[model samples]
Target: MNELNPLDRIRELCEQRKWSYYQLSKASGIPYSTLNTMLNKENMPSLPTLQKLCQGFGISIVEFFEPDRNLQGLTKDQALCLSLFTSLSQEEQQLALAYLKGLSRTL
Candidate 1:
């Protein structure tokens, strides 16, 4: 796996939240234009901007910068399962879980 930087981390955070850049800008109280420009330019955020992104993600700067995957308390498989589950509709999720439960009983 590649080393994740603050930018990559913040993007993943936003994606996990199903947020648009505009949504993140509103949440972070940062200007949408600035956020767009910075990200498009591949420029790292200033400390203040980084802090705002962290705030938007409901994480402290330390947690945002923490490179350890284990801190999330999920195995890679679990994380993949969760992300896939999140992409499903509420009814689809319920049905999928029910099917899994049924299959488990036959094991």
Candidate 2:
């Protein structure tokens, strides 16, 4: 993955959270025009704006600049499993788990 600057990182996190720029602006109470300028101009957000984003996400400002994938969260395997489970139908998941459990009992 390409390295992301602070603005890029924030944009990515917003996407990951399923937030639009407008959503972030509204939730953060930062002016939409200011946010648009910061993002478009690649200028840094004001400390207050940064604070609002960090607070909105329940993370610290320092943590926000860290590698996007390296944020304190699930391991890759855990993330994969989560993704897979979400894709499975409830009955398919139950049957699959039951089959695995049966195999475990026999071993």
Candidate 3:
């Protein structure tokens, strides 16, 4: 497999969310100037910073690097559902799962 550029990955994630750099800065809790410098200067974020970015994107670090792997064989709607599901809070996720289960029983 070819190597992935971290900066490009960040850009891709931001684009996926329809977020501008300023929005990302707010979500990631990184100063806009710092984020701007890092992206513009091609500087890689440190581990903690990367973690914050993943958190901001509502994903884990593993998902950040291999986003498509798990979703590869899923239908678009399934993938979208999974993406939306991951963004929910823990309690919300449980409720969603319960709702899905109820729906499944009716089928």
Q: Between which residue pairs do clashes occur in model 3? A: none
- State the RMSD for candidate 1: 6.4
lDDT of 2 at 37: 89
lDDT of 2 by residue, 3-67 (tens): 54778877876775667788778767787898898999889877888999776554667667653
Error of 1 at 54 (Å): 0.9
Query: What's model 2's overall lDDT?
Result: 0.71
lDDT of 3: 0.85
Off by over 4 Å in 3: 83-107
Model 2 spans > 4 angstroms off: 1-4, 67-107
C-alpha root-mean-square deviation, each candidate: 6.4, 8.6, 4.0
Total clashes for model 2 = 0
Q: Which TM-score value belongs to model 3?
A: 0.73
Q: Candidate 2: deviation at residue 31, Å?
A: 1.2
For each candidate, give its TM-score against the true structure: 0.61, 0.57, 0.73
Please give the range of 10 consecutive residues that has the lowest summed lDDT in model 3: 84-93
